[model samples]
Target chain A: MTSSSVPKRSRSAMDASAAATQALYGASDPGLRIRSIVFRSALLLSMTVALIAIIGIISWAVVEGGQRLSLGLLTNNPSSFRPETAGYRPAILGSFQIIAGVIALIIPLGVGAALYLEQFANKQRWYNRAIELNIQNLAGVPSIVFGILGLAFIVRGPLDMGFIAAAGSATIALLVLPTVILASREAIKAVPPSLLEGAMALGVTRWQAVWKMVLPAAAPGMLTGIILAVARAIGEAAPLLLVGAATFVTFDPNFWEGGYSALPVMIYQYAGRPQDEFHVLAAAGVLVMLGLVVVVNSVAVWLRAKYERTW
Target chain B: MKELGKEKLMAESASTKEEVFSLDGVNVYYGDSLAVKDVSFPIYKNEITSLIGPSGCGKSTILRSLNRMNDLIPGARVEGDLQYHGADIYGSDIDPVQVRKIIGMVFQKPNPFPKSIYENVAFGPQTLGMKGNLDDIVEEALVGAALWDEVKDRLKDNAFGMSGGQQQRLCIARTIAVKPDVILMDEPCSALDPVSTYKIEDLMMKLKEDYTIVIVTHNMQQAARVADKTAFFTVSSNDEEGSRTGVLVEFDETGKIFSNPADQRTQDYVTGRFG
Candidate 1:
């Protein structure tokens, strides 16, 4: 048996040296059956659990918000409690207005800070170290702490902008600026230095190299970071609570004046109430809030895949 | 046999080319440690001059200093005068970028941008904001590097997909696109196969009719084949804190340096002694 097996084994081994060595572990191996089953089963289980959670939330929200999910939810102002009669129209518009201002403020400032830190600033010195340290510390600072600061500075003090949409946007921008700067820096740092030098070698100045090669390479990444930071700002309530978010508003407030109410601020106001009806409203508001976040983040993920550098 | 004409000598008129770049009493230092010491040589115009030395002997450093690539490194300093076109290259008014544009360099590694073949050639002219008929310039550069026919149809394709030799040629095309007066290459053929190396060597011979080519190479045979004048550099001082740097032991006609070098050190190195 040994002699018979040795000859057959050697013959098969020689014949299948390169091909079966890989194929055997892939489609040819019988031993991997159980492992494959387990691997696929685990993957299915995670996806199934996620789907179940999503379906459960949607069903619950629809059941509780059946009467309020119509054009009224999109058109009417927030209410203290009239159940089917109250609407989130003002809050929706206010949230969008705040987001616009936040985007306007963060795009230039965040990208500028990122470029300064990643490209121009010398990393080997104390001043740069201090700047890096401060940014990291700011990222972890509590949202409520930022709210109190916004209250003191923006709502009342020198900035005395009231609880206007612009004021809320400013507060949220400050809250998300650290995140945007950090993400933009990571994206910029990922751009190959060789590309920059290649451009500069051609006779293009340092600014042109960055504008033409480095920044474009980093664009898709920066866009994703902006989306995530914007999404986070959209969902913030603690900062908005102190600055000036009202529980009820029939009409959308203009940017610079009057009270504003974002989805989170409205959700918080409803959820904190003792009524069971208000709690149901809060859950429904959560679904609407989550939908907005998903849409924005989906666009970001799409853009990331679109321009993903192959080289 | 092709006779030498005034046009063939037209590019050789850097005055300093017959003596174009002169390094007199040049000492290169990286922080307090000297990397190259007492190196004196002349790079004639429109000639291929190769610096051959052992690895880490600072052969590349001398090449880099010619274009002030050393200025990029902190704590890197040079003592002694390096004159280009009979003017001080180390002068306060001389911008490194302008110097680099005039004296282009090709690294030992083939570093093509993640761009198309045509774009790679167009990069230099684009940087200089050269107007009108860029298509002509790109085509000329590709033809000059002898890569036009091979890459002509696929000029829009990414440059990274090409073979190492082709990529090196592309880099040469890039350097030449700007019409630099001198081209410094740091072991441009080290990463290429033999066939590719021959192609590049042939290209260098042709290019010498237009631009001065200064190269640093580890291949003694390559130097003998391609270079008109060869400078032999060797490691001399031996210690940690004061490690030996590359010294120019001999600089003459390539055949003379290989056959009848005057200095014993140069002879020992040329014949493969303690290189």
Candidate 2:
């Protein structure tokens, strides 16, 4: 640790090496420059590959379905006898109702669970760890598995609310609940410890500190999570199938009382039909779903940019 | 000259001896491992007492225990008497939330809420349900922290907009807004530049006129410059566990501790020979 033991010539030794390197190559090393160029191009190539795939899919959907996408697509319900006039109006309304219900149910429950785990739970305890691990594992389970569970419990057995949009909503809510909880916990955990300590030092109770400081600090992240979960819920057709999302509902959906067909379920029904017109209609439904997903994700990004705390 | 130094020390010590906090045989632990063992000291009313030491010395840990902030950490426990106003802070009847209000804390880094400067200060008083002209309270606390002149023009601006020094002062303003009796500062200047550190040091001197302050600092010069009394801590090796525990090496008037420390460890640390 002494200066005497660290020879003064060590600096000169480093300088000499630097001078020798500079002499060998005047300003820059050609090998390093070539390596940097190669690395940069590799990264650029990877990005282009992903961009090409997305652009390819979107262009194909637009070209194939653009003719069928009209105002009538938004207003007219599906008709079995009239192939040209059949539309996804009921399916769109059904998707919205189901997503709205899912959002309403998930936000409070997911955020509450996250707050408990991050701010209140004693993480060292085995039960809390068990809950944490199970939530993570549940997020990875297939959506159709949730659908089966929903059919057994929600559609027929315990709750027994059969074939209603609310039942389908409940099923999707269960399917995405784990995703919301995991994302929310990450968001809540992102809040700085100093903010909590600052509030506590002001004589604010623990709950007050979390509510007033932590939750607000974490709001932008939670919003992003909710948006992503809703996106996933709207796109899932497999779960809706078992949870009683009817394939050919003609009426405008009622969430609490009637049969419903979501956009994906309608698309599925159309795609499986052995007719050229129905396939075009299915592509048009995909276009609508894609637009909705993009709009939701864009709103998430905007909300995050607006409300994100620098600290 | 020596006699003058001794007489001055005696006068300062005697005049400020009205005790605010008294600790006897205090031992702190995290889980089963000891952090600081058997620390005893008396902090006086309206005087600045500093805890100074190297890293892992538990000076900050002891400072936190005074306000029961240690309870926030899992498996952290405090043993022995840590008395605030003659009441055991660890007693069942005492609430940590209430105790925190009486003894406020400022952390090592400036951590302002992601709010306007005015709201940051107002938040504390609002939580306590103090009935008053909130505007006046906010203004008074900001002025007391010496930040009103700079931020008075933009009370509505987000606190993140301020410089690091201003932000730290805002934290002080926020702490004072609740009208706490004592303030605990944990390395308030470690993240600040020299000028900001000097300004904060000056503010602490002015603040001690109204509230008792206990600060933990790694910068020894800061301790010598602003603290009236200084307690030096050092890490002692625990042979059995191969762990180092913080132990109080010396406590005395800052001038005396710097010039004529009673313990060799304290002298070595202060003189920069060893820690």
State the TM-score of the second chain for every model.
0.93, 0.94
TM-scores of the candidates are 0.83, 0.91
Candidate 1: stretches off by over 4 Å: A1-71, A156-158, B1-17, B31-33, B236-244, B262-275
In model 1, state the lDDT of residue B245.
81
Docking quality (DockQ) of candidate 1: 0.41
Go through the candidates in order and give the C-alpha RMSD of each one to the true structure: 6.9, 8.8
Query: In model 2, which regions exceed 4 Å deviation?
Result: A1-52, B1-16
lDDT tens readout by residue for model 1, A203-301? 456677787778888988999999999999889988888888754666777888887788887877778889887777777787788889999999999
Which pairs of residues collide in model 1?
A: B16-B19, B16-B20, B17-B20, B17-B44, B17-B45
Report the C-alpha lDDT of model 1 over B192-248, residue by residue, as the tens digit. 999999999999999998888999998888999999999988888876566778788
Task: Tell me the deviation in Å of residue B143 in model 2.
Answer: 1.6
Per-model CA lDDT versus the true structure: 0.84, 0.90
